[model samples]
Target: MNAFGMNAFGMTALPTRRQLLSFAAAALAAGVLPRRAGARPLDDVVAAGRLMVAVYRDNPPFSHRKGGALVGVDVDLARAIAGRLGVGVEFMELTAGEAVSDDLRNAVWRGPVVGGGVADVMMHVPYQKEFGLRNPEAVLFGPYQREGFALARNPMRMTQPMLASLPDEPVGVEIDSIPDFYLLGAFGGRLRERLVHYMTIPEAVEALVKGDVAAVVATQSQVEAALGDRAAGFPITPVTFPGMMASSWDIGMAVKENSRDLAYAVGDAVTALLEDGTLPEIFRKHGVTHNAIPVE
Candidate 1:
């Protein structure tokens, strides 16, 4: 969701606040951690009375802090899963790594060098075949939400709400995001000078509100949250960049590879939450639409 994690939408993401973690090599080394190491089994987790959930810091509508309290979709999902397991929830807020692979190593299987030990389970991980295969040390599963991109435009500025018009109109995008790359590279770089960069999608959407840009391209949830009551003035629709990598994906959780039992238990809990409509409620509470459940 960049609503879920930074760099979740792109294969080659731009450098973020958490640059390529300097400890990646050591954390990802084959023998750095004993198999299963600190990852608690399902039984142990219940015994300890809490599930350590790792979520991205400052990821609004997903896991951001509000008035010094953590409240968002992913936070609520973690609490729901822990509630189902009869345990309390403990959060391990994460800074976005250069890529999701690095996040898996530092938060799911191996602890980062700076030393907040690995969490028992991490939320908002990309659930994809190639990505899962590449990070075999972590078992990625239980995709609860489907994420996609959208365009939020000021109707007063752009009479035409089509992707084709972006080349000629000013558009706002989060710096180093899928939207930024696509807008910069698409149409033979014609949109490069027309692009305005923001540190976050909400900022870009805000710029759209202020008429600083004709349109803002970002994850649907981010645009929705930013637009709030103002959404009526703007058209928000599912959008795609023709040749951009991963314009949409399913977001799930990750655990140590040795913790398959934990994965199964969490999966069952997630399925129950989705079936009973609790997940969608969480999204609605955050003012973000639950687009659709991830395809199995």
Candidate 2:
């Protein structure tokens, strides 16, 4: 029998060691195996019996801590992928770096000088061709969700649909977020005086729900999660500005460029999760609607 203890269809299986040795000899003779020694990230993960995943901390509905445990859509997804790989998972919560490139460098390939080191995979990476070109060391793939900004406003405060109505009252947004920057300069800087910045989108949305701000601009998922049942009273609408080139973009996972095998494996897992509707289910469990990206 073969090493797996299975015989071929209608034939006896070859002996284990002998057949393996013969195949190795043939492979060596044919130069099928490279002479250079290198360690694959996948191999390391399998050998260590654990997969390390990098996820952003304080981002709700994606990755965040809840009830004294790290829990979110991305957290569940990472655990699912690790289960598929038959390995344990270690989630490394990290604050987002200044830019995606810095995150890729610090989390995917080269770990920070002080931290525990790079993770095997990082979720919520922007799946843009231009971004991929800029960061060659990281391979961004498996576009799972398409995310975009939306404006959620308290109906009791402002009933106007136009963006010009916000000057009388302040509008809230996450500090340094795309919506914050967009509103800061929108309408020839007219809204600048009425812009209020919060540390996170949830905080901005909270202010809107409490009637502290007339409106809040943030991602659709973030707005929905923050508003919860109060969302029924508020209106969440897609937002478009003069300088906004794209309202939506796809988010994916990233791995070191050298870890193509792991990337492909993770991609397959993501595809399977999407096909079976597990990914969307995870998002729904977090009280957020999942906007899936069309697979190309």
**RMSD to native for every prediction?**
3.7, 15.4
Scored by lDDT, model 1 comes in at 0.81
Which stretches of model 1 miss by more than 4 angstroms? 1-6, 10-24, 27-37, 294-296
> Candidate 2 residues 1-296, lDDT tens each?
01211110011123457655753554454344333322247777788888889998877878988888999889999998898888999988878653555566667776653545678899888777766875678898988878777788877787865566664798998886667767888878888998998997778887887778999887888888888878888888866655545677778889988999999888898889888989899888887888888746
> What TM-score does prediction 1 earn?
0.89
Which residue runs of candidate 2 sit more than 4 Å off their true CA positions?
1-40, 160-167
Residue-by-residue lDDT tens digits, candidate 1, 1-296: 23213356734345444444543445466466454447888989989898999999998889998899998999999999999999999999998765677788778887775555789999988777777876788999998878889988877777776677763668998997778867788888888999999998888888888888899998998999988989999988788778766678888899999889999999999889888999889888888988666354
Query: What TM-score does structure 2 among the candidates reach?
Result: 0.82
Q: Please list the C-alpha lDDT of all candidates, in the order they appear.
A: 0.81, 0.75
TM-score, every prediction = 0.89, 0.82
Who wins the TM-score comparison?
Answer: 1
